[model samples]
Target: MKYDWVLFDADETLFHFDSFGGMKLMFERFGVNFTRDDYDAYQLVNKPLWVDYQDGKITADELKIIRFEGWATKLGITPFELNSAFLEAMADICTLLPGAKELLDALSGNAKLGIITNGFTELQAIRLERTGLSDYFEHVVISEEVGVAKPDLGIFDHAHQLMGLPCKTKILMVGDNPHSDVLGGINFGIETCWLNTQGVQTPAGIHPHYEVNSLEQLRMTLFA
Candidate 1:
């Protein structure tokens, strides 16, 4: 392996982040029939919170509780209760991306593995254990625990410190988001691979060291 430490982004990189589906399932438990229109309405409130979160304008707990504020009001529950319900729903539905298991299996011994996720601390541990992924990783650094999100230097710095500060060239960061994972790694002086699963054009002003269409392709690129 070319790298000593391999760090990954969680949602949409390793696990499927089916927010709509999870919301539907969660609302069903609360006796609400969630529709596509409902999802659109939800995103109007939810999406910006994520941007604010990654930008360090909001704390992880704030984003989690605030996103469900309207729903909590309607359901006669606290926002934290609704958020926990949604996360539980998400955990129940969590699955590895198609090639994620295979790639991790191959890298298990050859490279040290860790997760750097902007995802909620509540959801990550449950899903990792549920999916049998917990043992594969040496560390699971969470924004909620670290007090900083990705694309920020603080979270990456924390992960590096926990890693015993490996040489920048001997570490590789991989994720689906070009902005957070690719740009953050590049700025932090580590090698990076962007997992462009949807084949979208790279957004202007950011570039990753490598790009691949899928985890299988990433696996091949790393080991070929």
Candidate 2:
């Protein structure tokens, strides 16, 4: 393998993060039918919170509460309660992305692995354990736990420290987000692979060292 350590972004990179489905399941528990209109409305509030969280303008706690404020008020529940419910629902439905298992299996002995996720602490552990892929990773760094989201170098620095400070050239960060995973790794002086499953245009001047359409392609790129 070309790299000694490989770090990954969790949601949409390795796992299928079906937020709308999770919300629908969560709202069903509250006896509310969450419709597509409701999901669109929710995303209006939720998506920007993620951007803010990633940009370090807001903390994870703030993001969690603010995104659910409207829903909490409508449901007559606290945002904390609603957020917890949503995370649990997400965990219940969590599944690895296509080829995730195969890629991880192939990479296990060749390189040390870690996860650096902007996803909540409530869901990360359970999702890993449930997926039966927990043993492959040497470290799991969560933004909520680290108090810094991706695109900021702090979280990557923290992950590097946990990795015993591997050489920058010998490390690779992989994720679906061009802004966070690609830009962050580039800024941190490490190689990066953007999993551009949707074939979105690369952001201006934020180039990744590599790009692949899927984990299967990544597996081939790395080990073929």
Candidate 3:
């Protein structure tokens, strides 16, 4: 089957979230004088806040503040200071995943590309623009801006509408997460491609139409 519009997930799909370079900058900026264990623990604590934020159970500002607050509290640091540092570090850190540019370039003219991410509009925009990938996409629908997150069929419907596609079947939703990306696409009747970078098994019940370990495989899978 041929797809006209290709929707993508931002963070782990196009870029690595655990960018060590970015983390180093963040550590220095925040003056976080903790051991590696602290950093690891902080990430463990902070990840669920993002899930909550995406699920619409928490506000954006609350998410921003709380993640740092939780981390700071655990490490006996001031939340305000950590929050300030985090914001600055986030703005300065821009790292693209492998094959990101190549994949975007390959698909640019061949299909209508769009970004459907469950992230803040400003941050996602900054990363995309910094990576010089903003031009490849026709539309970027971020959850915070849209007032809805993925796994919710509404956002999928909105993206489909924005693409001006006749139906969901004509579009391909590609991303790293099974719950958010794959299940969300399936919920909307769009063909789903699991960007299983880690080579994990397809979870118990969910099924993706296509499964690939890298974006580089996309061209061959879809066109060849």
Candidate 4:
């Protein structure tokens, strides 16, 4: 029952980022005026930049500017305008996942909590602050800040080092991704709990110490 630290994944775990809304707002804010088709194209082009950014192949700023530029060029808009609009829209639309506050409240004083996310520092910080979830974490490690992403042992090590917990066995990683969150924790020899909100079967060759259907399930599992 004794746990020294718990690390969480940010995007789907802590917050549900409305990427579609944010992108639509970005077009409106930038005055580019794109159609649904255009937005679809933009999403296709922009998603891979995040993977590259997480892999340390691109800088955070590069990923942002490139995503904006790619979408703008495809939509026949100026990249600079798109960039400004996207930043503004993204800042406004970022929000927390359902039951995030309640779960945080339940875990707050009971154990040390932190976040390990694969995202740009600016985007992650804006989301965390806007959602008021930043206060719950003792430490926050982002791939953009650390030059490494999840599923990479280095990021896990960085988080563990920052936590300064005496025992790795007492640390728990909770995340939605099988390859990233669960595999990453296993790689580092830390206990892992998969947040399988979608109820999907565990993928081949990966296993978590626990599986949770929802944040509420997590609360009950931890405190009940």
RMSD of each: 0.7, 0.7, 2.7, 2.5
Worst 10 residues of 3 by lDDT: 17-26
- Kindly report which residue stretches of model 3 are placed more than 4 angstroms away from their true locations once superposed: 19-21, 70-84
> What 10-residue stretch in candidate 4 is worst by lDDT?
79-88
Per-model CA lDDT versus the true structure: 0.94, 0.94, 0.79, 0.80
Clashing pairs in 3: none
* Candidate 4 local Cα displacement, residue 193, angstroms: 1.6
| Candidate 4 lDDT | 0.80
What is candidate 3's lDDT per residue for 133-161, written digit by digit as tens? Answer: 87889999988777778888888878877
Across residues 1-224, which tens digit of lDDT does each residue of candidate 2 receive? Answer: 99999899999999999999999999999999999999998899889989999999999889989999988998898999999999999999998999999999999999999999998999999999999988999999999999999989999999999999889999999999999999999999999999999998998998899999999999999987
Between candidates 3 and 4, which one is better according to lDDT? 4
The TM-score obtained by model 2 is 0.98
How many clashes does each candidate structure show, in the order listed? 0, 0, 0, 1
Name model 1 segments beyond 4 Å from true.
Answer: none
